[model samples]
Target: MSAATSPPVSPSAVTSAGRLAWLDALRGIGALAVVAEHMLPWFVPSLRPYWFSLGVYGILVFFLVSGYIIPASLERHGDVRAFWISRFFRLYPLYLVVIAVVLALSWWVPVREAVVRDGSAVAAHATMLLDVVGIGGVADTMWTLSYEMVFYLVVTALYLTRGHERSGTWAIVFAVAAVLVGLVASGAVFGGGWPAYVSCAVFVLGLTGVLVGRLRTFSACALGVMAVACLLLSSRVPWLGTAVLAVMFAGTAIYRWERGTGPLWPVAVTGALVVIAPVWAIESGWWWVQADVWLTTILLAAATFAGGMALRGRRLPRILVWFGLISYSLYLVHHPLLRYFVRVSGDLRGEPLAYQLVMTAAALVVIIAVSAVTYRFVEKPMQDLGRRISRRCRGGPQGGGEVRVPGESTGDDRVLRHEERQVPHRVSDDVDQGESVG
Candidate 1:
């Protein structure tokens, strides 16, 4: 709400285009976390437990972003079918591909004992319902799907109801979460509902933010400071505090960032904190490290959120924006690829350290390559099909839909004008997106 001025990093001159670019760039960072966590787990065990935790943030970011965008999407569409179909197209095809790949890999590695010991867990993951209980099977990375799906169902249902009342949408979302709590508490699904519930809470907070509009006198610097504090505070007991503060602080960041309401210091300082936080964790001892990681992650998430807010009407490289576009497929597919490497290599010690490193890079490269192909051949086609079908069903916007990117809301089912459109045939043979590791 700071008079809608642009952020420091320049990019496209379109309204909200920066949001897409910056958010995707942020997601690219999250995907790297997933890729690195798996590739190096053999090298670092302590960080292993936190892999799913960090990877899960990518999903939470996406889901909450979706909630913020849903209302805007509803406003733009022909009707709800377009909305639902669009979502189905966006999610299902890529998911189906991942599931198939997982099955194929699991068969190859049946190493039968692990599967026998954890077949049920594997089954839950394959079905994407593993979140019903707190147990994550072999591929722990997919745990966020439960919340993503739940958030999608709630938001889609709201859209389908043809009720755009912000309060009403949130009421329904919370009610669904409450029912989920009841179900989980009774052990009906025997799946813990914490992640899903926490995500749901975040989604609701996002929805509230959209409806409430920008905060008054909300200096971006203040937002950044508050975000860092809340982030560190939440780390003390992540399941509760971290999740809650993530919603609150990150929520503020998104609002101000989207409105372009804050100053450069917020983004600059936030980015600096992100860079230093990991070192803080390492140098300050285990306790600080734990809290600092969460703090760093959220602050970076916020910073990129701001990046997305600014990318519009500014000038930045096309490569950065492109990465944001393909981020989804990269995220969904990376873990299975990582596990495949683990299963195939048998022992990391035998190969020269250089060779092991090569093996890791090879695995990531293959996943990215395949994911890029999937994006062009599978995902894009399904999206086009959805658009054509939506047009047939409701005949408005001619398949124009919207979705939420990490930091900001892009409109709905069909992508909005400001949001980057998915070209059915475009492939950046090089994927030259800028580095996200900072």
Candidate 2:
């Protein structure tokens, strides 16, 4: 590695909070791909084959990125309280705003409101795991958040139990278990009335156990297993959901190995499982049967991740990096914006494809503009506040931070107490924090 790209080898090294710029570019690409995946179908009906939805490709990329980063974030903070607090601030603010916007818009456009079944809407909205607990999302795109939450919780559990180093092994185990469980019982493990409530209750208890139980290690391990079970059984799309998570953990394993924290074999094993498990599920009559598209998407996701890692040292364009900075905002805002646009404009039928393309282009412009505003006004400020609170809660000096993994920095730490007083107009270190898209 070049000196500039090399990870820090000592405590005194000046680690940075800057992300690899190319990864940000990838985030931007993934966000826009999702936008196209949803928007294109409305415009181009011909593209709607069971072959591949760009949406799946985009989300899988996001899952991989999340797996890579979230664990690193937790380990860096080394304080579960701070990590949770930071995560809450990082995700919830924009999420709430988008939900509020969508809810407000639903007054005029009834379709904007998601299906509410048996008063489960509130719980689903509150937890963002609507699909997992046998409920629907307020927004269709929000279902992915449920899996992301489970990943975070399970990650936290592993961390607490000091078993995080075995993430790859666990990932493989989950994938294999998903395959085994799919054979006989491929539905919700817990059935009967209020299954959502029961799942939520178990999640809460498991979360509490890991966070504060006297036997936290055992609690964490048990909770991790239960969480995997929930993923494979209770989620609306069990096989796909389980695979998404396994892919994410594979990303995590890749990151760990990249950072010299683990060996390549575990990542290799996880990658093998990642490829084999989903295919097995499909072939065994447990999941979707679109092997051609699904397999291609999986390979594409793997290639994209590998490409990002290979290109980590190269400089990426400013606009792409900026798009990455605002990607979360884009991801959250696009669906609502599209819904409102479509509601107001009505169907664009009978118009030329070019005209629809123009409209889509206009929508993209609007989404980006709104996302820029939200990132600046909401995401960035909340992140700063979260950092301050986290630092306070950790009882550290106000301006200081530490890097985990003593020999290498993950580029998530900020340097404080610089002698130079002048701040640059554009902060080069305005790295996007979270990997979860929505």
Best-fitting candidate, scored by lDDT:
2
Clashing pairs in 2: none
Q: Count the backbone clashes (under 3 Å) in each candidate.
A: 27, 0
Clashes of 1: 27
Question: Candidate 1's residue-wise lDDT over 88-108, tens digit each?
Answer: 566667777776666676667
lDDT of 2 by residue, 94-187 (tens): 8888778766766676633345645556655665666666666656677788888878778877777667777778778767665555454455
* Candidate 1 Cα lDDT to native: 0.43
Candidate 2's displacement at residue 2, Å, is 24
lDDT of 2 at 240: 63
